[model samples]
Target: MAAGAPRIFVSHLSGIAVFDPAGDQVGRVRDLVVMLRVGQRPPRLLGLVVELATRRRIFLPMTRVTAIQSGQVITTGVLNVRRFEQRPTERLVFGELLDRRVTLTETGEEVSVLDLSVHQLPARREWEIDRVFVRKGRKGSAFRRAKGEALTVEWTAVTGFSLEEQGQGAESLLATFEQLRPADLANVLHHLSPKRRAEVAAALDDDRLADVLEELPEDDQIEILGKLKEERAADVLEAMDPDDAADLLGELPTDDQERLLRLMQPGDAADMRRLMSYEDRTAGGLMTTEPIVLRPDATVADALARVRNADLSPALAAQVYVCRPPDETPTGKYLGTVHFQRLLREPPPSLVSSILDRDLQPLDPEAELPAIAGFFATYDMVAAPVVDEAGSLLGAVTVDDVLDHMLPEDWRETEFHLDEEVATDGS
Candidate 1:
């Protein structure tokens, strides 16, 4: 084997063949076993399964294996036919060792792992297996128990072979946010190093980034934002709702906040500025620029087509508003709102006015937070349209925006916990 090449392990005595000095097949590889010490008992090589050309499986001693290579195994000597007749135990030790999860100690916490490490002792010319490293679970807590608390095992503590399954059909060493639930992603973020966090943020698409950001704590959001370049920070902010953008920007240094705002699109920047202009705890401050508006004369087909053309967020309101003109009043004078599902099910050629629900509930742009929350709760609304005093439609507020205000501190902490959990689980 070449020095420093990736190492591989095969089942000992797994019907491998070896060549002698004359370049002839000698015998099948029998056993490559290691001894474990559980408080000073004499170590044993442990029996291994070996097979011969006669189609017989046998128990082979550990000393038989001479060399191991990428594609084949070599044995020390040719075996007698009768020696291969003995049957070995059907169960393999390695499989049993890996079947259970391990917990390693780290910074006074236990970390769960799917595998352990194996090492060779040159001085004693023996192999040693000790210390298990965890790859999943809470950011700082492990699934397994140790002496008092899980002990942090050093990298050097791992000596030889890794117990993790190799080759195909193994769990991936690297985990992506897609593989994790939003809650899990939040937990993992807390444990990630600054650079790793940046890498993960950079890897997430705009929509996913927005979702993950909404779940993160304010302090974490500010920390992550500080680490990102202006353009990337702007991209993440652009993906966030106006209220979220305002809150995160409020947490950042004034200069950084201004620089990021400058990098955002003019319209997005304007909306964020307007939202921030209001007191942080008001309805206008939390509304989104995602109201569904349709011209009164527009047919159900036209409205559906417009919906198709627009890049609407998933959290958008189900109700589509009907307006006489873009700048006209949105009160009783105009055709009201219709559920999107109703529009889709109705005949395409039907006029929006024929199905518009006139029993519309509108929100004042300057309404207080509690009143808006009550409106959302009472009506069971995902979004409520906001209008000026003259009833000119301003924008809309979604449930998530309201949630930010209702439980600001708890929400931030939950997000922080989630980020930490994901990092530990990912490792």
Candidate 2:
């Protein structure tokens, strides 16, 4: 810790309420923002990412922070409600720094960073990292440190393995990304250099990479896909939602797409080929072929479990499809749909067929965008089934995919469009 300077560990700051001079709670600390610099100098603290009561994230500069105490942070009441955008030199302390690998200069042993402390310079507006909490043993739990036994060391005595120090290496990048949600990781990936982005993408597991790819803009998705080996790219495509995978494949040259598709599993390749046959704006093109399917004999409990799958998006999981024998697309037969709400209201052991919305018809595979939108509005459903001429369930269109088609082609690149809830306090 700096001489006579009050300090708080970064981990302890999570969820700490922020109060104005009058002790009126304004928001809570979400993450600490800092600038990454060259040399061994500690990264300069930039501001705090604060979440308002309304759940909007905003930036609160260090200049507005008057005091940092246990359980609460006192601020100058001058909060900037602008959405926090990390600049090229900046990083989030908790997001990219906490839980990272660092080497203790004195012991020459690698340890996991548990927390970091920053201190303001005497009579100055500057705040810089001065102390770090580290735990011995790379595989040990981060919370296993001895009680009241401070392992705080001078920041200069240890080395951070973040992107700035590690260059385009995947290990350090993986360390940071491992803690982030796929969408959050995607946001960070979008801001990195092309080479760095490729390195990070290569380091991610197929499923994790697929999740992150689904969140990236179409252009970014294509560029990163091009960097991967052909076989690995095929695997990632298979892991992605069939709709998203097909859309990306459509952007590639026909021969290139064919070669890559041939590398994928036979079943997956067939599905992608089928999806590619539909126009991009049609219901078939906007649907995922992997919607949870249940036999009529399946119970409500089974329906609930399927919708809770981590891989399925919330919109796609809003309902379950009731199909006849051979519960695969093109399914044996389309019976009806069962909304999750109905499952919750019904007895756990009740058959799914008993609660099926038989009157709810499926969309034709070639249904246009306007028709799909009308179906969602009229039925008040997040997803609707798509069927073929033989009445086989091909897939289900999700509201998110429909919205994507309705928006401009470059909507993902538009800052305001990316996050609908992002707004300012009129400051």
Instruction: Encode model 2's per-residue lDDT on 1-427: one tens digit a residue.
Output: 2335787677788889998877778889999998665446677787889998989888887766778876888886666666776654478887888877788777788878878887788767668888888877654444456433337788878865433634446886688567777776787777676767888888889999999998889889999999999999999999999999999999999999999989999999999999999999898988899998999999999999898888678988889999997898999888999998889999999999999899998999999999999999998989999999998899999998898888888655433312333223223
Tens-place lDDT digits, model 1, residues 295-404: 77779988787667445654563777776675322333335778788888999999888998777677887898899999988987788887776656767788877877
Cα error, candidate 1, residue 341 (Å): 4.0
> Best candidate, TM-score-wise?
2
The RMSD of every model to the true structure, in order and in angstroms, is 19.6, 11.2
Query: In model 2, which runs have C-alpha deviations exceeding 4 angstroms?
Result: 1-57, 60-168, 414-427
- What local lDDT score does residue 105 receive in model 1, on the 0 to 100 scale? 25
- Could you tell me the TM-score of candidate 1? 0.55
Q: Least lDDT summed over 10 consecutive residues: which range in candidate 1?
A: 416-425
Judged by lDDT against the true structure, how good is candidate 2?
Answer: 0.82
- Cα lDDT for residue 1, candidate 1: 26
Q: List candidate 1 segments past 4 Å from native.
A: 1-175, 181-183, 306-317, 327-335, 412-427
